[model samples]
Target chain A: MKVTWSRRHVLETDDWSREEIEHVLDTANGMLEVLSRPIRRAPPLRGRTVILFFAEASTRTRVSFELAAKALSADVVNITATGSSVEKGESLLDTARTLEALGGDVLVIRHGSSGAPYFVAQRVGAAVINAGDGAHAHPTQGLLDAYTLRAKLGDLAGKRIVVVGDVLHSRVARSDINALVPLGARVTLSGPPTLLPAAWRCGDLPSGVGYEPDVDRALDGADGVIALRLQRERQEAGLLPSIREYARTWGLTEPRVATMRPGAPVMHPGPMNEGVEIDAAVAHGARSLIEEQVTNGVAVRMALLYLLIAGGEPRLIVGAEPPTSIAGGEPPATPLPTGVV
Target chain B: MTTFDRRALEAAGYLVVPGFIDLHVHLREPGFEDSETIASGARAALRGGFTTVCAMPNTEPAIDSPGLIAELVARAKAANAARVLPVATITRGRKGKELADLVELAAAGAVAFSDDGSPVDDARLFRSALEYARAADRPVLEHPQDLALSARGVMHEGRVSADLGLPGIPAAAEEAAIARDLALAKLSGARLHLQHVSTARSVELVRRAKADGLAVTCEVTPHHLALTDAWVAGDRTVAWEGRPSPRATPFDASTKVNPPLRTEGDVRALWDALADGTIDAIATDHAPHASVKKDVEYDLAAFGISGLETALPLLLGGVDAGWAALDTVIAALTTGPARVLGIDVPDDDWTVVDRAATWIVTAAGLASKGKNTPLLGRELRGRVVMSVVGGDVRYEGDLRAAPLAVR
Candidate 1:
C-alpha cells in the first residue's frame, strides 16, 4: 500500500493517532523481514546521513539506532556529550545546526532535559527522532514495545497491559501509555507511590490508563507485563527506602507473574537489576520478551528512519526480486530509483 | 499640552493615572549587563508606565553595601528614565550567612532590604535581619521559597509538571517559607513584604497575617494573575482559559520563571484577592535574562521574563476581562506599591494610557535588552502613550498613531 507519510519528526507519541501508529507498526513488520534476512540491508536511505546525538549515556538505544541507520545504508555518526563540543557547553541548538549543516538528514537525539528533543526539533530542519529525552519520552521504544506485544498477541484492542515500577520517571511508561491507549489497550501502572505518583490517574494521561499500587492486583488477568528498571539514585534521593525493600515489596517475581494470564510475556527496558525489579527466572524465562523488545527496537527505528527520511517509499535495489513480506507485504509496482529517497 | 493633542487623547479615551511604582524589578546591571542595564531597564519601565521601580539587588556582588547603593543611585540618575529605588541585600554578599550594614545601606538610598533571588534559609539569620531592618526603617522583602522543597524544580508542582515529567516546585515551597517569615516578622515587629506571591494559600496566609495585625504586605505579578503553568505546555491559548487542543507540544523555555506560573484555580484566587484588597500590590517582577540564558533547554534556561514593558497592558487586559475592578488594579500598581515602600510618589509624575489601544508584544519592540517573555506574539490591550517622571516627559509614544505602530 502507498503511504503518504507527512510527519517530519517523531518526538512523542502523545498526538499520534491509532491509524498513524498502526501504519508505523505495519512498516516495522517489513523492516523485521529485512532484519531476519542474511544480507540484512536495504538501499532506501543509501547516501543519507543519520546523526545519533546522545547527550545522555545509553548503550541499548544508541546502538539500536546506529544499527537501524546502518541497515538502511545511511552514514551514521555518533556524538556523545562527554567528548563532543557539548562538554564545552555548546548549546543543543548549535550542536543540531552543526550536524544539520554537515548534511544530517535525520537527528536522533537523547538528552537529559525533558524537552531537549522538542527544543532541537523546533530549531532544525532535519527529521528529528526522540531517542529518549529525560523522563519525558522514548517514542521509538514505546512503538517497539507495542510492536513486540502486537507480534506476540494479535490486535491489542482492549488488551490489559500492566506497566510496573518507576512510572513517574519512566519516559518509556509515558510513551507506552501514549502509544497503547490510542491502539485500544488498557494500561495499568503499578509501583511504589514515590515512583508511580497518584497524579498519573487524574493528570493528563490518556483515558485508558490507570494506576494500581498493588502489584498483584495490577497484574491480575493482565495480557502483558512491562517491568521498568529501578534506579539506585531513587533510593539515594529518598524516593525509595532501600533496594532490598523495593525488591521485597514491588519486585516482579515468579508469583507475581503467575497472577497474570498464563504465558503472558514479561518485558523490561533493560540494563536490568536482575534481583531487584524482576527476578532472574522471569527475565530469562520462556515468557520474557525483553530480548525481542531490543531486537524489535532496531526494526521500529528502521521503519521510522525510512518513513521519515525516505518518505514512506520502498527503494530496494533496481532489479532484485522483491523480498516477500517487505514494505507491508506488497512490492512497489514500479521499482523506480528516485534519488530523493 | 496643545489643544489638538489633548482632544486626540480625550477622543482615544486615554486615562491619565499616577505613574506606576513597581516594588519588585530586576535591573540586572552592575554584573549581568548582557541581560539588562539600569538605563535599559529604566527605559523599559517608563515604556510600561512605571515611573519609579525598586531595583532588586540580586546582582553580582549584590548591592550589599552603601557604596553599591550610591553607585546604583548614580546610575539611575544618569539613566534619566524611571526613578530606580535600590534594594540592598539583607545578608552581606547575600550569602545568607552574616548580616549587611542595613542602617548604612538604607541611609545610602536603599528603599528596601532583600536577597530577592533566594530566601534567607536560616531562620535565626532571617529573624536577625528583620530586627536589623526595623532599625533601618526599610521593609525586608522576602523572595518566599524553601529551596529544599523547590529543589531543582523548573516549574510549578501540579498536574502539568506531572504530565510533562518535569520536576515541580510545590506550593508548599512558598507557603513554608512564608510561614517562617511571618513568624519572624511577628517576633521582630518589622514590616515584611512578600515578593511574587503565586499560590492561593500564600494569599490566604498574608490575609490572615494582616487581619491578626502583623505588618505584612505582598505583591503579585501580572504573569501569575493572567497566565498559568499551562503556558509551559506550549499552548498560548492556555494562558487564558480552556484545555489545550491536542496539537499543543511541550516546552517553551520563555515560560520558565522562578515561582513558576501556577494553576487556573490559583489565578482565580489571585484575581479574587486582588479585588478584595488581600493582595496589596501588582508588581512586575520584571526579571530580564539574556536570550542565550533562555534559548536553551527548559531545565537549563534561566528563570525570568522581560516583563517591564508588558506589565501595564497585561493588568489592563485583566481589568478589561473584569478580573478585578479598574480602580483596584490601578491602585495596586500605584498607591499600593507606594504604601508598600513608604514613599510619597509625586502627583505630577503620571502616565497617559490609551485604554482603547491594543498592541502586540514583540521582542524587537521591547526597550529592555532581555527578549525572553511568554507574551512574545500576543496582542495585549491598553498602551502607555506617554510617561512623565518628576514632571519631565521620560517616554512619549505617538498618542494619535494606530495602536499597532505606536509601540
Candidate 2:
C-alpha cells in the first residue's frame, strides 16, 4: 500500500487504520535512530513554532512533548491555564486563536474538557495535537504504547493485553484500545466493578476487547499489561471503599505478574500510584517496560509531529497495508484531495 | 373566527389548526438574558404557530412567589405575541426542600407549578407540592431524575453514548424518578405532568399510570421523536487513521439535552404513544442557550436545543412521513397541551401551515436569541406560513403574499 499524509489534527485513535498504525510505527523507528546519536537534532521542523497550551496539570506529557519539539529544532512556547488570559475570562476558542495569531505553527493542547483540541483544529490553520483531553483520546500516548509493546514482544497480533485500573476515567485506556485492537491484539479491561462498569463492556467494546472485574482472571496468560492511575477521589465518590482495599483486590502485584506469560512486560502511562494500582518492586521488575514507555513516548511524538507537519509533501511510501482500518475492519480511508497540505 | 374559502385554502396547500399551546419552554428571562428574553422566546413561539407557552420556573430568582408570577404575566402581556403563562417553581428557589405557596401563585396567574430543569428529588417535598397543587387546581409538572444515579452522565445511557466515550445517563435515572412521582401522585390524587418523557420505559410507565386512573400526563420533544443518540455519534475518522478533521465532533455538543435522546426503540415507543393517545401533548421544551454556552465540550455545555422555531414543522414532517395522522399531531400541539394547563382553546386563534412547502432552518433566520438548534441546515417540510393570535396576525412568513388567502 502507498499512502500520503495531509491531515492537520491529531485527536482520537478510534478511526485509525492498520496501515496508518504501522506507518506511525515505521516513522517512530526512524525517530528512535535520530535519538540514538549524540547531540541529536532534526531540522525538518527547524523554522516552525510549537505551542503547548495546557489547561490541565501534567508532568510527563508536557515535558516529553517539549523535548520532542526542541529536538526537532522547533521554537517552543508553553502556556498554562492559571495566571494566564484563560483565567481572565478568555474562551477556549479565543485563546486558541490568540496562539495562532502569535505565529504558532503547531498547537499541542491538554485541556480539562474532552474534544477541546478538535474544536481548535477546526478553526485554526496550525497543526493540532491532543496532548490529553478529559477521558477522551490521547493519540500519541496510544501510539507509543503500541510501539513499546511491538518492540519488546516482536508482534502485537494475537497477543492478550490486560488494561487494569480506572478504565472509566483513564483517557489512556480509551487510546490503548484504539491502538491495540486494530492490530489484531485482544484487550481486556480489569478493575473494580465501579471503575470497569457494565456500560463499558456492553455497548461499544470494539470487537477485540472485553472487560473482566477479577484482575487475576484478566491477567491469566496475558502477554502485556497497562496499569492506569487510580485517583484517591474515587473512594471519596463511593466508587471504592479505600485505597488499601483497591491495592489488595486490583493492584498489579509481583504474584499477579508471575501469572502472565514469563517476561510479559508491564507498562504504565506513569506518575504511578505505586501502592494503589501497582507495587514499586513490580514496577522496577525485569518484565517492567515502564521506563521504556517513557523513552518511546518522545520517539512516538516525534514520529507524529513529522508525519503531521513534515510529511505533508506529495511523496508516497510503499508498504504492506495492515489487514484492517482504525475502525476495526472498515475499508481503507479515502485519501484527501491533492495538494490539501 | 374569520373563515377562509375552502377552495382557496386548498389551492394554497394550507391547513389551519388551532394555535399551538406549549406546556414547557424555558424563556430564560429575568436571568440568562443573553440566551433569551421573554419577548424573544414568545416571538419565536408565535413564529412556530404557538399561541400560548408555559414558561418554566428554573430561573435565577425562580418563580416561587406570587409577585414573581405577576411580574412574568405582565412581561408576557407586554411582549404581545404568544401568551406566556408562568409555571411557578414547586419549591422556593427550586431547592427541593420547602414548598412554595401554590395557592397564591395560582391566584397570581401561574397556570402550573414545576421545577422543570431541576428535579424536586425529595419524595416528601414532591408529595407536599402535589397535594398543594390539587387544592390550587393546577397541575404539578416534575423534571424527573434520580440525580445521584445520573450524576456525571452527559448523554443517554446507551450504545451511542458508550461509543462516544461520554458518561451515560441511564434510562433508569428517569424510570426510578417517575416511579416515585407516580406513587406519590397515586397516594395524593394530585394532577401530575411528567416533563420530557425520553425513554420507552417512561412512556410505558405513563401509560400504565393513566390506565390505573391516576391524573398523569407526559410530553415528548420533537428532537427526541425525530432523532436518536446515533445522530449524536456521527461519523468520525480517528486521529491515527491520518489527520482527524475538526468535523469529527460535529454532532457531539449540539444534540445534547436533558433526558437525552434515547434509542430508536424509544423513538418508536414515543410515536406509538402519541398515536395511541397515551402521551398527552407535544412540547418544544424550547430551551434556548447562547452559542458560548453550547459550543463547548458535551459535559461542559448546557443541556438544551433552542427548539421553539422548529417544533411545529418538524412534527409536521413526522405527519408527512406517516408517523401519525395530521389531526392527531395537531391535537398534541394545540388542544392537547391547552388541556394539560387548563387553558381554553379559543376559536379565534389559529395558524395556517403550508404542508407542502419546504424551508431550511438557520440561526440567522430564527426569531429566538439562541441559535443552538441541532436542526440547522435541515430542509424540512410543513412550515407555518402565517399565525393569528386573538384575531391578530402575529407572524406572516414569505408565502403570505402568495396565499390563495390562507387564513
Candidate 3:
C-alpha cells in the first residue's frame, strides 16, 4: 500500500500512500541517526534554494522549517506578505507563482488556504512542502509528529495517538492527522466545536483518521498527545473565541498528563504561550516531545528534501510500509457549501 | 419450543400479528465471523419474531455474485427459522467499483442490492448500479455517505458533538450521498432504497426526492430513530473508549453501527418520516459482532450491534415512548419492511389477532447475542405473539404456533 509521494495535495494525511508515509517516517528516522552521528549531519540540500512564504504569522513553524533548510545547507529565503502585497490586495495563487518564478527550488509555504501547497506543487516545477495552510494542513508538522511518535512508541502501526486543541483552527493538528493516519497509527483529533473541522471529512479519513471532540475522552487510552497551540492571532482575527476560556478548557496541565496512558508523550508546535495552550510544567515534563519534535523537523524535512531530489527511483529504499484501511477516511467532506474561506 | 401459557402472554399485553420483516440484517455467512455467524444470528432473528430478514452483502468475501446469493438462499431455507432474503452487492466486492451481475443475483433470489456499509463513490458506478437494479426490477440499497463531508466526523456533527467534543458526523454527509443516489436513481429509472439514514435533513432529502418522482425508499435504524450523540455527554469518557462514532454514541462497542445515531431532532424527524410516509420501512441493520470485537476500546470495538431480537419490542416501545401510533408501528415492522424488500405478505397468509400486544421485557430475556441493547428494561407497547411466515408459525411466544396459510 506504499504509494508514491506525488506532490499533489497536502490536505489530509492519506493524500500520500502508506508507502509514502513509511518512507517519510523511515527517512526521518534515518535522518535522526544521521543527526546523532559524530559528523552531526551532511547537507542534503547543498545547492537547493528553499523559499518560506507564510501568509499567517508564526514564530515556531517559520523557524523550524527555516532551520530545517539551513541544517540541510540549503539557502533559505523568508517572506511574510502580511504587510506586503497582501495588505495592498494580492491573491495567494499569484504570490505562490511569483515565488515559483524567482528560481525557488523548494516552496516551503504556509498559507490561509487549505490546498495552497498542492496548488503551488502543481503550478511550479519545484518541490513543494506545506509549512502550514489555512486551517487545512501542515505536512512537516505531521512528519515531525510521526518522527516523535516513532521515537517514543518505536512503531506507529498499532499506536493510539490523540491530538488535542483547536482542530478547526490549527493547521498543525490538521496536517499532523494527515501524516499520522498514513503512518499506520490510530489518530484522533479532538477540540471544542468552534475548533472542530468538518466531521464528515474525518469519517472516511483515508488513512485511519479518527475524530473525537472531547479532549479528555480522546486522551483516555492515548499513547501520545499532540496539543495544538490555539493561535492567539486567530482570536484577534475572530477565528476563535476568548483565549482565557480556551486555556481553561483546553490547556494541558501536569495533572491531566498524569491521567494519560503511562509514558504518553505530549507535543506542541511551539512558540506556545506556555500556560495558555499547555501548562508550563507539562510543557517541560519528561513526556514532552516538543523539543524532540523540533529536532526531528530538520530530519523530517531532510527526508522530504532527499525524497524530492531522489524522486521515484530511490523512494523504495526508504522502507515503505503497508497501508491501513478503514471504513472511514472518506473525503471531499461536505464543504461548508460556501467557498467563503 | 419451550411452551408458555397464553394467560402469561396476554398478561404481558402481547398479541398476534402477521409475520414481521426486517430489511437490513448482516448474517455474515459467506465471510466474517469475528462479527456474526448465520445460524446463531438467525436464531436471534427468530427469537425477535422476525419471520424474515434481508441480509446485507458487505461481508468479508462479499455477496456480489449470484453464487453467493444462491448460497445464502440455501443456508436460510435450511435453517428454517426466519426467511433470509439476500441483498447482493451492487458492485463487485462492494468496493463501489464496477457493477456486478445484477440479473444473475436477482434471478438467484437476491431481493435487493447494496454496498451496505459504504456508498458507491463513483457516479458512473452508482448510475450503472441503478441501471442494473432497474433492469432487474430490484432496489439498490445504499449506505450513502458523501466521503468528503462525512470525513473527520466520528459522530453526528452538531451541537452535541461540539459540546461533547466528539468529531461530528455532519447532517450533510447523509444528505450528500442520498441526494447523489436520488439523482442517479432518477436518471437511471431505478428503485433506490437508502439504508440507515440518521439525520432530519436526510428525511427532508428523501421526502423531496420522492416528491420529485424519484423511486426512492429509505430505512431508519432503531439506534438512529432513538438515541443521539448526547448519550456520550452522560459520560464523555465513552467517546474515548478509544473509538470514534460518527453517528451514534460510542456507548457499548457492540452497539456501534454506521449511518450512526443522530440527535433528538433527528429522532423526531425519523418518527415524523414514518408518520408522514417519508421513511419507507423499519430495518434492524441487525449486526452482531463478538463480545471481544465490540467490547474493545470504543475505537477498536466493532462498528455494529446485533438488533434482530429487539426490532419488534423496540418498535412497540417507540409507541410506549410516544414516538409512533399502534397500527403505524406494526406496519413498519411487518408490512413496511416486507414491501421495501419487495415481499408481499398478506394477512390471510397469517393471523393478526391483536396489534396492541404489550411486550414488557428485560434485555436478558431477548435472545440477541451481543449485550449491546440500549433498550434494556424498557417496556414496549406491542409484541408478536405469533409470526407465521408463508403459513408456518415460525414464532409463538405465548400464542399458538399454527401453520401459515399463505401460498
- Which predicted model would earn the best DockQ? 1
How do the predictions measure up, each by TM-score?
0.94, 0.92, 0.54
DockQ of 3: 0.03
Q: Write the per-residue lDDT of candidate 1 for residues B1-407, one digit (tens) a residue.
A: 32224445555567778899999999998999999999999999999999999999999869999988888899999989999999999999999999999999989889999999999999999999999999989999999999999999999987778778898898999999999999999999999999999999999999999999999999999989888888898866534444454334579899999899998889889988899888889998999988888888999999988888888878876776677788999999999998888988776788888776778888899999989998887777788888888778889886656443322
Scored by Cα lDDT, where does model 2 land?
Answer: 0.82
TM-score of 2: 0.92
All candidates in order of lDDT, best leading? 1, 2, 3
The per-residue C-alpha lDDT of model 3 at residue B223 equals 66
**Which candidate achieves the best lDDT against the true structure?**
1
Tens-digit lDDT track of model 2 for B273-391: 99998898999999899888987766788999888888877787677667888889989988888778877787778777886677888889999999887777767776787777887
Kindly report the docking quality category of candidate 2.
acceptable
Q: What is candidate 1's lDDT per residue for A217-293, written digit by digit as tens?
A: 99989999999999999999999989999998889999889988888899999989999999999999989999999
Query: Which pairs clash in the backbone of model 2?
Result: A15-B238, A16-A326, A16-B241, A17-A326
Question: Distance (Å) between predicted and true CA of B141, model 2?
Answer: 0.9
> Where does candidate 3 stray beyond 4 Å?
A1-194, A197-341, B1-14, B235-251, B346-364, B376-382, B398-407
Measured with C-alpha atoms, the lDDT of residue A12 in candidate 2 is 77
List, for all models, the DockQ compared with the true complex.
0.57, 0.36, 0.03
Kindly indicate the candidate among 1 and 3 with the higher lDDT: 1
Tell me which of candidates 2 and 3 scores higher on lDDT. Answer: 2
